[model samples]
Structure formats: C-alpha cells, structure tokens
Target: MQGAIARVCVVVVAAILNHPLLFPQENTTLPDQDKELMARMREHEEKLEMEQAKLEKELSQLESKQEESSSEDGYSWYFWSTLSFVIFFTIELYRVDLTDTEIKPVEDEDVFSESGSVTPRTMVLDKDVLSNFCDKCMYTSSHENWRVREFVEGFADDLLESLRSVCDRDADMEVGDFVGIGSMFESWKVCKPLMCDLIVPFSPPDPYSFQFHLWCSPSSDVPPGLQGCGKIKVTKFGENEKGCLCGSANMGDDMLCLLHSRNDTPKVDHSPDELLCSRNTPFLAKDQVMKWFQISVTKAWGRISHKYDFEVTFRNLDAAGALTIRFRSGKVIMLNIIPVVQLEDTDAYFVSHFPSDCDSPPDPYWPLSFAVYEKNLLKHFAKRLPQNSCHLHCLQIVTFLHRKQTGLTGKSALTNYHLKTALLHLLLSKKPSVWGVESMEHRLRDLLSFLQRSLQEKRLHHVLIGNSKVPGDVQVPLIIRKAEPINLLRPLVLQRELHAATVRHFTKC
Candidate 1:
C-alpha cells in the first residue's frame, strides 16, 4: 500500500511541475514541453507587437488627416475673415457724419443802425442822396477837379497875356485902339457910351423875305450924317432887296448885320490884290479834306436831319478875285475885298465847276477812273486813320464806288462784260473798292486762277445753256467701290459719286 501511494505522489508532483502558475519549478528539466511553451509565448508576443504597431500607424494617419483638415479650415477662415474686414473698413470709410453742431448767432447791431427798430441803412446806400453825396466827395477828392481848376486859371491868364502881347506887337495901335477891362460882361457897360444905337424896325412879313434893317455908328454923340458909318437895309419882298428873305424878325439887327454885310465893308489900307497874293499862296495842300468834310457833314446831318439827307457844295475862290455869292433862293451878294485861300489846283478846278452834274448819269470812262482813284486813296488813308474812322471811310467809299460802278451811262456788250467780270473779281477780293487799275487786274487774274483750279478738281465746271452751238466740258461722275479679293471675284459692285452728271441724269429722268 505504501508503493501505490508513492506512484500517485509522483504523478501529482509531475502535474504540479507542468502547471504554468506554479513558481518553484526549474523549466530546463522538461525539454520538449518547455520548448513548446516557449514557442507559444513567443508567437503570442510577436502577434501583440505587430498589432500595436498597426494600431500606432493608424492613429498617426488619423492625426495627420485631422491636422491637414484643421490647416485647410484655418486658411479658409483667414481668407474670409480678411475679406470681411476690408469690406467693413471700406463701408466705414465711406459713411457720412450726420451729427448736429452748434452755431453762434450773429449780432444785428453790427450790420444795422441803433434805431428802436432795425433801420434800412444798407438799403439806403442805393438812395439818390447817398449816391450824390458819394459822387460829390469822390469828385472833390479826385485829381481831375484840381486839374480843371488849374487849366481854367491858366487859360484866363494866358488870354490876358496874349492880348497884352498882341497890343505890344502892334506898335501902330494906340492904347485907345483896344479897350481893356476886367471882364467882357463888365466891359459892355464901360463902353456903352461909345457904342452906337443900331435900330432895326419890323416890316411887312413874307415867306421869302428879310424883315429887318441894320445900322452901325462910332459913337452915340454923333449927329445923323456922322453916325452913318455903316448901314444895311434888309427888306421883305422888294425887288431892290439882295439879302436872304426869311419870314421872321425874331433876332436883333446886331446879329444879322455881320452875316449880311459884304466883305468890302471890312476896309483896310492893303488892297484886295496885295492881300490875295499873300494869302493865296498855299503851304500845304490836301485832297482828302473834302472826303473828311463830307464824312463829318454826313454824320452831323444824320444826327440833326431825319435820315442824313442834305446837299452841300464846297466852293474855293481866289484871294484876289471878286467874290460873288449866289444862293438857291435868288439871293446875291458881292464882295470887293480879298479872302484867305488854300486851294489846290485840282480842288480849285473842281470847285470852279461848282455843282457839277454829279447826281446825273456818270460817264463810262469817268466811273472807271473814279473807282480806281477812290480805291487807292482809301487804302492809302486806311493806314493813317483810326480804326473807327477807317471803318466809316471804308463803308462810305464802298457805297460811293458801288454807285459809280452801277450808274454808268453806256451799256454796250463789251462794257457790260467788263463790268460783270470786274464786279465778280471785286466781290471775290472782299475789299472796299476796285480802286486801282493794277489792283483790279491782279484780282481778276487771281479769280480766274481759282476758277480754273476748281474746274480741274471737278469741284466746279461750266455748263452751256440755251441752244448755242458751243460745246463745254461738263463735270462727269466718278464712282468708287470697296470689296475684298474673294468678294471682288463675285459679280456686282455698288458705289456712288457726287457730280454734275448725276444731277443731269436725275434731271433728265
């Protein structure tokens, strides 16, 4: 029975040694079993290590994906955030401030007067009283007033000095020859005793008659015969009366006597012949005087008359010759004394034939010559005259020259053609006159040249009218077209040209 117990115990010991949980065993003692157990543990450990490695790799991949997603989201957010900030900033910058601010009130007393209510001081500035006051003050303070006063005083002193010099210059004249006084107004009374009583009696009135008599004497103390130094009788509607017979006697005889008396009344020691010789000599001669005079007279008459309608004749007489004046109204006056003369031969000749038939139809040659002279004269004067004066003269010359050119008497075919050509050329030049023959020829040539060039360019061409046998070269229409090479190879082309031929074609249709 002890041997059986020993076997069971051996088995129990073996089983206890093979158990893995048992800690007191030596493992090398069982070779195959130990090898097998070690192989299983090694396999399990290798499996666990591989599994951990795979898990770690998967976690790293997941982390990398998360980080990439976060970076992309951050970039997107930053882009959107920057754009939104810029938009907000721009909106803020463009916004307007509508806030209210305080304003200080203006003081009324600074602009207004100290009346109980506001006075119209500013409005009164435009009033006449204020304006006049300001004007007066300005005038008083200006240099013009002082200058005017100085001029007046100097003029008065100069007049007195000139009179004294004149008296001293003429040694033959005594102090009594010239009665000097303080003023012309005061001298009248002082010389009243020496003055003559010239009585003018009213007479029968007539529409064309003078109605007054004029008388002059040296002193009032003289008797009838001695007082008759000068006497003139102006009668109304009598055959003996030679003076102009106006219907009225409203003016005193003193004023009329001077104008009515003949030049012979102013008698001196020098004879009319000697005085004429001295005065007739001309130092300067001017042909433009009549033009200037006409201009001035026209302007003056234009101001006075209804429409510058009047007739004036300029007469030049020899200083030594007998002067006989005749008026449109059968009044004649004769003078035996000499007059100052500045007559040019041309002007004198023109004046000698006074009141020529200038209004009548002009001679053909005269018109041409006149036109030439007038044009050249105007051009010459234009440089010397003021702008306004030159313009006025130009207008006058144009009117006069136009009249002269159009008012020729002869109307022959040759003359008509010449005039037409001249006028056309003149019109082209756009100058005031056709003045000179040379200038007219030049302008005519220029016009012909222009027309020739125009014809060559097909801009203008002559056409024959009526059934004349003349054949003229008329302008022909030229057309143009636009097409590419490919299109050009096709059938038709379309174009149009502006020409006389087109016009004629339409007219014929």
Candidate 2:
C-alpha cells in the first residue's frame, strides 16, 4: 500500500510539472527558434488582451454619445416663441430643423392660387386609385354607421324623455336637447364607427352666462393653471339689464362661427330676464355643477336604460364638467353629452362648465361649447363635396392616425377637432374645385404641410378665437386671441413622423 501511494504521488508531481496551465516556466532545453516562437506567442496574447480592454472603453463612449443624440429631438425653440402673422394672408410657412443648419426652401407658394393647382408633380396613386379607395372605404363604413345611428337616435329619444320627466324638480339641473355629433354622427367615420357624440344642453342659473375672456398680461386674474398664458381672452360680454351679455348682439352672430361653422344668427335669448338665475349656485367650484350633472345624468339614464339593449356607463366627468357615457353592446359606443348655450343674437357659443375667466367672479357657471355649430359646419362641407371627393377620406385617415398614435380623443390636444379646424381653413382658403379627385394626394400633403408650418411657428390659432381671419363681431379675448397656441405635441414630434411618410408613399403609389 505504501509503495502504491508513493508511485501515485510521483505520477501526480510529474503531471503537474508537465502541465502548461499550472506551470509558468517553459523548458529552457528547447532550440533557439522554438524559444523565439514561444516568446512571439506570449507577445501575441498580451496584444490581444490590450486590444480587448481598449475596445471595451471605446464601446462605453459610443453608447453615451448615442444617448445624447436621442435627446436632441425632444425639444425645439419654436415652442417658446410668440405667435405672429403678417398682414398678407400669404403665410410664409417654414420649419427650423434642429439637426440641420441648411434648410431646403419651400417652393414659391406665391405662384399658386385658390383657383389653380400647384406646379403639377409626377405624383402616383393619382386620381383613379385614390377615388376608388375612398369609395370602397366609405361604402364599407356606411352600413355600420346607419345601424349605429338608428340605434343611437332611438336611445337618445328615450333617454332625453326620461331626463325631462325626472328633471322637473330642479330647474337648473334640467337637461334640454339630445343631439348627435362627431365624425361617426356626421357619417365620415372610417375603420371604427363605435363612438357617438351627443350634446345635452343644460340651463344656466339666471343672469350669469358664459363668454370668451382673454388675459392680456401679467396681474390679470385667469384660471389657476393658465397664469403662464397672459396673451388674450376669447371671452367677452355685452351690457344688458340682467348683467348678462347676450352674444346675439349680446348674442353676437359670426363671432363664434370660426370654431364651428354656422350660417344662422342667434334669434332668441335662451335665458331671459324673467327666468332668473339660481341664487344657490356655488362660486368657487364649477365642478359642483358637474357633480349635479353626474348624479342627474346617471339617474336619468337609469330610468331609460331598460328601454335599450345596451349598458349605459358614465365613464368620466371632463375638466369642463362634460359627462362621458360608454355604451356596451357587442361593441363600445362612447357618448359625450355636452351642456352648451348658443350666444343669443351674435351666434357665439358656450359650454355648461363655464370657461374660466380673467375678470369674472372666482366662481363659475357654464363656459362655452361650439360642438353643435362646428358639426353643423361639417355638414355643410360634407354636402358640398364633389362626387367622390377626398375631404371626408382625408379627414378620416388623419383622424385614425391621431387616435392610433396618441390614443387620444377629440377632447385632447391635436384632436379630431383640431384636424377639423385645419380642414375648415383649407376649405375656406381654396375653391371647391381645388379639392377635386386629381388633387387628392396633393391636398392631403398640403394639409400636413400646413400643420407642420403652424407647429414650427408655435401657434395654431384657435378658429373660434380672434386672429387675422376672424369676423368683426367675433370677440376673442385680446390675450387669448393673441396668446401663443398650445404646443401639445412638441416633445413627441418623432413618434409621429407619419405625415411625411404618408406623403412619400402616396406620391409613389
């Protein structure tokens, strides 16, 4: 046993001496060339190790540089600029690309006119393909829309009827008409026709009413969060016996027409002197009215929901106190029942959750909403469209893009409402012939180009508010009318580079 152990120990010692990993010293008895070769191999390993460490350091530096580059697209100086428009209606639409010092000048727009197309491009998907695509999409959507409309009309009739019966107890809490709105209601809906907009008019407490109020400078008392925007107020009131400013003269016609399109002037004072405002209304919290609406609307719908097969849900109360209703059948139907007042003779409009004012009382009543009048204008645009025109098609496509990219609704910034505002501007700027089928692709490009230019200027002028183009009777607040427009998507410019991509693809088609 001792002999066997001794032999094994000797074998282990020899193996350790022979092993390259465990033994550091090399055999000195080798030839000179072999020794030189081994020295060269060791030098080679040392070089590899040095190279790897250097590469690791360089990789870390590159990663940091990439992170910094990513942040550059996050902001632009245009966001903080003051809005300006020169006297000529010919706008110098431009962009200040932060990444490039050299900008490609836009083709001279001075060459174009309302009556003619721009220098015709060798654009693809020309007239025929575009017209056919629009038709098929419209045809596909119309049936679903008809069914949804029929269902909603039935639902609204029963709902408003129930509201009228139970709402008699509280005069201020009473809801007036139930009118449908939005793209779905207007029949321009594309892929998803699941939502519906309904206007539910609320009667204001006597004497007090909603109007546009602009804040011109610092020291002006505006809404709590809106102190930074001391530019203009779209709200204004005229003198009357009840201390109420009727937009008719008091209710000024054409004043509120910019936000939404309307032809008829206001004829009646919805709230007259004999109908006194409620003394019980709260001053500080207009939300109290929203609370009133939430309870009154939900309970009112409860009495009527049984008549329809769908489930009625009061999803949320918006900042202005508008109530959102979600109807669930096989699909979802979103109904926005907004309380509003159309200004008397002036034809301006206001919503129930009173717009926050600068000079007015700290407490609020209904502000203003122009949804109905806006939709009314949409109807006019729809009716006048040439056969298979791209106005509705273009609107639907952009609207879908807005919803998909932002997951937003009309209430938010860059809403379908804003898109409509852009469309209205284009409609008014050019002749109906300019929106013909052959010009569909260019018209779409033109709208996107218009938005890009406006964004770069940091001002998307409110259509209802005063600007270079608004009517005389339309009294938008000086500060609000002139204040820098909201740059809601300033930080998100990259997430939606789709506008350029859209033009590129369509032009190629």
Q: Specify the highest-TM-score model's number.
A: 2
| Candidate 1: residue pairs that collide | 209-245, 210-245, 372-435, 375-435
Clashes of each: 4, 45
- Tens-place lDDT per residue, model 1, 1-509, is 33223333443444333333332133332355577787776566566556656655655565565434455556655665566566555544443221111122335434444432222222112235333533453333335434433433443333233333433222211111111111111111111111111101111112212211111212323223221111112222334656444324545545554434534332233221221111233111112222322333334333433422223232332211122334456533322111111111111111111111222111110000112122333344345434433232222222232334334532111121122222323342445343332243344334434433332343321111111221112111110011111111011112223333322221111
Q: How would you encode candidate 2's per-residue C-alpha lDDT over 277-307 as one tens digit per residue?
A: 2334222233444556666667777787666
TM-scores for all predictions:
0.14, 0.51
Which regions of candidate 2 fall more than 4 Å away from where they truly are? 1-133, 168-171, 191-193, 204-285, 317-329, 345-347, 352-367, 380-385, 407-413, 467-509
Global local distance difference test of model 1: 0.28
C-alpha local distance difference test of each model: 0.28, 0.50
lDDT of 2 at 367: 39
User: Against the true structure, what is every candidate's RMSD?
Assistant: 42.2, 24.4
Q: Candidate 2 lDDT (Cα, whole model)? A: 0.50
* lDDT for residue 433 in candidate 2, whole number 0-100: 72
